[model samples]
Target: MRVVIAGGHGKIALLLARSLTSAGDEVAALIRNPEHAADVRAAGAEPILFDVENTATDRLLAVVTGSDAVVFAAGAGQGSGVARKYTVDSGGSVRLAEAAEQVGTQRFLQISTMGAGQPPARGSDKVWAAYIDAKTQAENDLRARNLNWTILRPGRLIDTAGTGLVTLAPPPVGRGDVPRADVAAVLTALLPAAHTFGMTVELVSGSTPISQAIAQLSD
Candidate 1:
């Protein structure tokens, strides 16, 4: 399958690209920085330079054209401010979904925060408030699109190695941490899962094997 990933230079995106490529799938990474081309290439993905934050939706058509799926994995980065959250995370996500629909791409995947649907209370912090609001708004917008969408809301993301296991389900759980590589693994595992469509899965580190966990997903 041909997959297009926004924010292809991101850690998770890069890991996902490698996994997809290793599985013999055609992978394309959409990135804003040309300097990151080599890094994306090293991961065995074709890199497409595009700026979803500033570019028109039409400008993204070529990237998603004929692709099997579109993954909205872009973010404003760690040190970015509140405004950037709305632009890159919120606006970029909505635009990716819009572009996917416009290009007739049927599958859309989104990487979201664990508590976005019900963000934590951060009193008086405009930046945190904006971030949560952006994620919440983006998720809502994606749900309204005419596509097979799967939203993975992961717990605190860590840089530890993957355990090849995870706890995937609907909400009502407390906080926890999940390795970035594990998240990427789950993302790859769900790539062709029709059962994951229309599902917003909550993920965290656990003892269940990836395959076993994904197998329990309800249609």
Candidate 2:
């Protein structure tokens, strides 16, 4: 399978790319920084320089065309301010979905956060609130599109090594921490799963193996 990942340089994205490429699948990562090209390439993915925040949809279309799937992993990142939360998180996700629709790439996987659809609590930090709101809009927008979309909302992400085990279920899966590598493992399993279409699931560390967890989704 050929996959296109937005935010290619991200921790999860790089892990996913390496796993996919090692399995003999083709992977192209959309990266904004030219300097990140070597890192993406080292992970065994072809890095396409495209900024999801500043680029046009038509341009994204060219990059997404002919790919088997598109993964929306882009984020505004820490200290980027509130406005960018909407532009990069929500807006970038929608742009990828639009391009995927136009090119007939039916499989679209989005990496979201656990609190996406829920409103922020009273007196929450403005940026945190905006991030959640942006993700909520992204999820809503993807649901409205004519595409096979799966949103994976992982809990507090840690950089620890993956355990290859997780609890995958629709909300409320409750709060917990998950290794970023484990989330990438789950995405690799879900990429070609037709049964996962239209599903919104949450992830965190647990006993079930990654493949078994995904398979159980259909059972």
Candidate 3:
């Protein structure tokens, strides 16, 4: 399968690219920086320089053209302002979904946050709370698209080693943290499942094995 991953420079994105490449699937990553090209290539993916936050629809469509799947994995960095959060997280996600549909890419996956369905609580001072708000909107927008879409809302992402164990369900229950590598494994595992189509499930680490973890969501 040929996969196009947005935000290819991200930590989780790199992990996913490596896993997919090792499995012999064709991988093309859309990276914003020229420096990320080497890193992405080192992971066995062809890096296409394109910023989701700035690229035109035609440019975005070109990147996804003839691809088997489009993965919206882009995001504003932690230190970014709230406005940038909306532009990169929300606007970029929606645009990626739109471009995927326009280019006839059938499979779409969004890497979203765990608390996406809920509103911000009082006294929350993250300043970037808008990031959560934006993610929520982007997920909803993609869900309404014509393509077969699956949104994986993983919890606080840790850089720890991958246990390859995870939990998955509708939402609210799978609201704990998990290793980024584990999330990448689950994403790849979902590639061949028809049941995961049109679903937006939440994910986190649990006692379940990797295969079972993916089965829980795809089922």
Give the Cα lDDT of each candidate.
0.90, 0.95, 0.86
For each predicted model, how many residue pairs clash, with residues at least 3 apart or on different chains? Answer: 0, 0, 0
Query: Best-fitting candidate, measured by TM-score?
Result: 2
TM-score of 2: 0.98
TM-score to native of every candidate shown: 0.96, 0.98, 0.96
RMSD of each: 1.2, 0.7, 1.3
Error of 3 at 115 (Å): 0.6
In terms of lDDT, model 1 sits at 0.90
Ranking by TM-score: 2, 1, 3
lDDT of 3 at 34: 100
Cα lDDT for residue 86, model 1?
A: 97
Best of the two (1, 2) by lDDT: 2
lDDT of 3 by residue, 25-135 (tens): 999999988987999999999999998888778888788889999888899987898888899899988888888888899999999988887887766766547878999
Runs in model 3 deviating more than 4 A are none
Q: Alpha-carbon error at 210 in model 1, in Å?
A: 0.8
Off by more than 4 A, model 2: none
Tens digit of lDDT per residue, candidate 2, span 1-219?
A: 899999999999999999999999999999989999999999999999998988876888889889999999999999899999999999999989999999999999999999999999889999999999999999999999999999999999999999998999988998999999999999999998889999999999999999999999997
